[model samples]
Target: MALLILTMVRTGEGSINSLGAGGLITLEERDTLIAFQDFSFDTDGWDRAIQENSLPGLGPVLDGSVDTAVERVFALPEETALATIRFDMFLNGGWGREDTIHIILGEIQTLALGWPSDNSELVTFARDGLSVLAQSALLDPIRDNHRVARYSVELAVSFPADRLTLRLVPELVDGAQSNWAIDNVSVVARGPEA
Candidate 1:
């Protein structure tokens, strides 16, 4: 019995056991690339106005302090083992404690952080956690010396995600006093099948 148990246990992680002709066959799982966003030409596969509010003189970006947010629904297989989301994010104008962003992923959270038991995944980045950039890239001559910064952020998540809803919402502190942006986003999943 011990020999049989050890034989079954050494098939490697994410390997499926299949009974073949008088033997066991193991199937391996691999990563599946799912590129969700390419903001170079236009914004596709993303929610319209709500997901993005373009600045009058800027390239494609999701802009708004809190009132506007970016949301994308990814339809993946029900057996996805791992997922990674990547994006280039930035915040323009002044920001404070209230400028933190919330990342809510349905099933990606491994442990509960006192949020709702419904898997309320939460993560943040603001203030000192990013690199401040020059506002000259903003192109608007409205004023000078406004707090501006950008960061390339990524998150590792898990899912049996049939319908995955990923949302990035900034806290609404002073009601649209400042704006933010996100671009070059992508999501990759790994599983037994596509």
Candidate 2:
């Protein structure tokens, strides 16, 4: 498992603020270059509104205090390991263990692990201890059935690429409403795949 360093940054201001919020996770010695505020809908990069509403008891936003799930286009400086895109993600509301968040890399779709159907999944097996505790404590009673929690999953696929458009699709398998939030998304070069 590669080590990930999580850090948050903010740009612009208020709800209409562009770029909204973003995060960066360093992978040690790797050259990570990101243009701040590039994720704003106003810009040509990100496509969608940057959500700014407070997530009840979830405290401030995980990184930049701006929570949003929007599609964006990015180019890898070099060839990247499209097989696995890793990042920090959060899910809220009633979702089943089988329900997954779709990672669309260019045209490929990889179903990533998502929140469990029951709240007990957190207390029982402690799948994600910190995220579960944060979600359980900050979840609003009226908003959704359960609190919000964060998890990091490596989206497995075998596509190598120099540029890719990415989007996260939330599919509710159990006919329940759910929200997915993400931050610190990144793709690292894996050289030529033999």
Q: How do the predictions measure up, each by TM-score?
A: 0.56, 0.52
How many backbone clashes does every candidate have? 0, 4
Measured on C-alpha atoms, candidate 1 has an lDDT of 0.47
Cα displacement (Å) at residue 138, model 1: 14
User: Per-residue lDDT tens digits of candidate 1, residues 49-123?
Assistant: 324434322345655444555677877755777665655455665555445666566533221111112211224
What's the C-alpha lDDT at position 2 in model 1? 45
Give lDDT tens digits, candidate 2, residues 80-150.
44323445456666656666666566675544446644442322112211111111122335354566655
Off by over 4 Å in 2: 1-24, 27-30, 35-44, 57-70, 78-85, 96-98, 117-145, 155-159, 187-194
Cα lDDT listed for each candidate: 0.47, 0.43
Candidate 1 runs further than 4 Å off = 1-29, 50-58, 107-143, 174-176
Top candidate (TM-score): 1
